[model samples]
Target: MKALIVYASVHHQNTEKVAKVMAEELGADLVPIGQAQPSTLTAYDLIGFGSGVYGKKFHKTLIQFVEALPAVTGKRAFIFSTSGGGEIQTHAAPKKLLMNRGFSIVGDFSCKGWTTWGPLKLFGGTNKGRPNEEDLEEARVFARGLKEKYI
Candidate 1:
C-alpha cells in the first residue's frame, strides 16, 4: 500500500525519526510538510500525519496541512506524535481534527521526548535519548499493524 508520511519537527527531530521508521516499515514515501503543498489524498491508499507536540497541540504547520487536505472519505489514515508529557490532548487534538475531516483513523502512536524548553529540562532531563531505540521499534511494529489491518 502506498502511504505518505507528512511531518513537522523542531528541536530534537524526534518525531521525524519515528516517521522515518514508520515509512521504512510500510515502504512509504516521506514528505516534510514544509516542502509539500496541500494536495489531494486520492493518490495514496494510506496516510500518516505526524508532528512534535507543542503546548498540548501539534505543530502549527501540521494543523494547517490537515485542515487543507482534500476529503479522505474512505482512505485509511493514522496520526502519531512525540511529546515530553503524557497528556492525551497533545495527540488527541490532531486526531480529532483529522477525523472531523472525514479521514478514517486507523491507529495512533506517541512517546515522550526530551523537552527543549521550560522546567521539564531543568531537573536533569525527561525522556532524554528518546524517541530512542525502543520508541522506534514500537513505531515499526505499529506501522506493520497499520499496513496489515488497513492497507
Candidate 2:
C-alpha cells in the first residue's frame, strides 16, 4: 500500500526519527512537512501525520498541512506525536483536524522525546535519546497493526 508519513520537528529531531522508522516499516514515503507543498498529498492510500508538541499543540506546519489537504474522504490515516510531556491533546489536535477533513484515523502513537529547553536541559533529566529503541519498536508494532487492520 502506498503511504505517506509527514512530520514537523524543531530542536531535537526525535519526531523525524519516529517518522523514518514508520516509513521504513510500512515501505511508505517520507515527507518533511517543512519542505512539502500544499498539493503534495494526493498520491497515497494512507497518510500519517506527526509532529513535536510545541506549547501543547502541534507545530504550525502540521496544522497548515491538515488545513490544506484536499478532500481525503474514505482515505486511511493515523496520527503520532513526540513530546517531553505525555499530554494526549498534542496528538488529539491533529487527529481532530484530519478527521474533520474526512480521513479515517486507524491508530495513534505518542512517546516522550528529549527536551533541551527550559529547566529540563539544566536539570539534565529529560527523555533524551528517545523516541528511543522502545519507542521505535512501538512504532513498528503500530505500523504492523495498521497494515493488518487496513491494508
Candidate 3:
C-alpha cells in the first residue's frame, strides 16, 4: 500500500526517530510538516500524523495541517507521538480531528522521548536516550501489524 508519514519533531527529533522506523517497515514516505501538502494526501492508502507532545497536544503546525485538509471519506489514518510521559491523552485531540475529517482511524502508537522542556531542563532531562532501541522495535512491530491488517 502507498503510505506517507507527515510529522513535526522540533525539540529533540524524538518523534522523527519513531516515524522513520515505522516508515521503513511500511515502506512509506516521510514528509516533515513544513513540507507536506494537504492537497496531495489523497494519493496514499495510509497516512500517519505524529509529533512530539507539547502542552498535552501535537505541535501546532501538524494540527493545522490536518485542519486545513478538506474532509474525505475512507481515508486511513494513524496517530503517533513521543513525550516525556507518553500519555494516551496526547493522541485524543488529533484522533478527533482526523475522525472529523472522515478518515478511518486505524491505530496509534506512543513512546517516551527525551524531554527537558520547562523546569525539567534544570534537572538535566527526562527519558534521556529514549525512543531508544526497544521503543523503535515496538514501532516496527506496530507498523507490521498495520500492514498485515490493512495493507
Candidate 4:
C-alpha cells in the first residue's frame, strides 16, 4: 500500500527524526507540511500527520493543513507528535479534526522530545537527548504494525 507522512518539526528536529524512522519502516513518502498539498493526499492508501507539540498542540501549520483538506470517506490516517510532556491528549485535537473529515482513525504515537521552548530554555531544556534510540525504535515498530495491518 502506498503511504505518505506529512510532518512539521521546527524545533531541534525531534519530530523529524521520528518521522524519518517511521517513513523508512513504512516505505512512505516523507514531506514537510509546507511541501504537502491537500489535493495530493488522495493518492495514498494511508497518511500520517505529525509535528512537534507547541503549547500542547500539534504545530499550527499541520493543523491548518488538515483543516483545509476536503472531507473524504474511507481515507485512513494516523497521528504522531513529540512533546516534552509526551501526553496522549496532545493527539485528541488532530484526531478529532481527521475524524470530522471522515478519515478512519488508525493508530497514534507519541514520544518525549528535547524541548527548550519558553521557560524550559532557561533550565537548559527538558527531556534532553529524547526521541532517542528507544523512542525511535518504538516508532519503527508502530509503522511496521500499520503497514502489516493495512497493507
Per-model C-alpha lDDT, please? 0.82, 0.84, 0.93, 0.93
lDDT score for candidate 1 against the true structure:
0.82
RMSD of 1: 1.7
Report the C-alpha lDDT of model 4 over 14-41, residue by residue, as the tens digit: 9999999999999999999989999879
Give the lDDT ranking, best first: 4, 3, 2, 1
Task: Compose the digit string of candidate 2's lDDT tens values, residues 13-106.
Answer: 9899889998888888898987887566777788888899988888998898789877665689899988988556777777787888889888
Candidate 2 wrongly placed segments (more than 4 Å)? none
Q: What is the lDDT of candidate 4?
A: 0.93
- Superposed by TM-score, candidate 1 places the C-alpha of residue 111 at a distance from the truth, in angstroms, of 0.7
Extract clashing residue pairs from model 1: none
Clashes of each: 0, 0, 0, 0
- The true-versus-predicted C-alpha distance at residue 23 of model 3, in Å, is 0.3
- Please give the distance, in angstroms, between residue 95's alpha carbon in candidate 1 and its true position after superposition: 1.8
Full ranking by TM-score = 3, 4, 2, 1
Q: Clashes in candidate 4: how many?
A: 0
lDDT of 1 by residue, 1-151 (tens): 6788889988688889999999999988898888877664567889898888887788999898888876656777888888887444676777778888787788888887777567766776677888889888989999999888766
Better of 1 and 4 by TM-score: 4
In order of appearance, the predictions have TM-scores of 0.90, 0.93, 0.97, 0.96
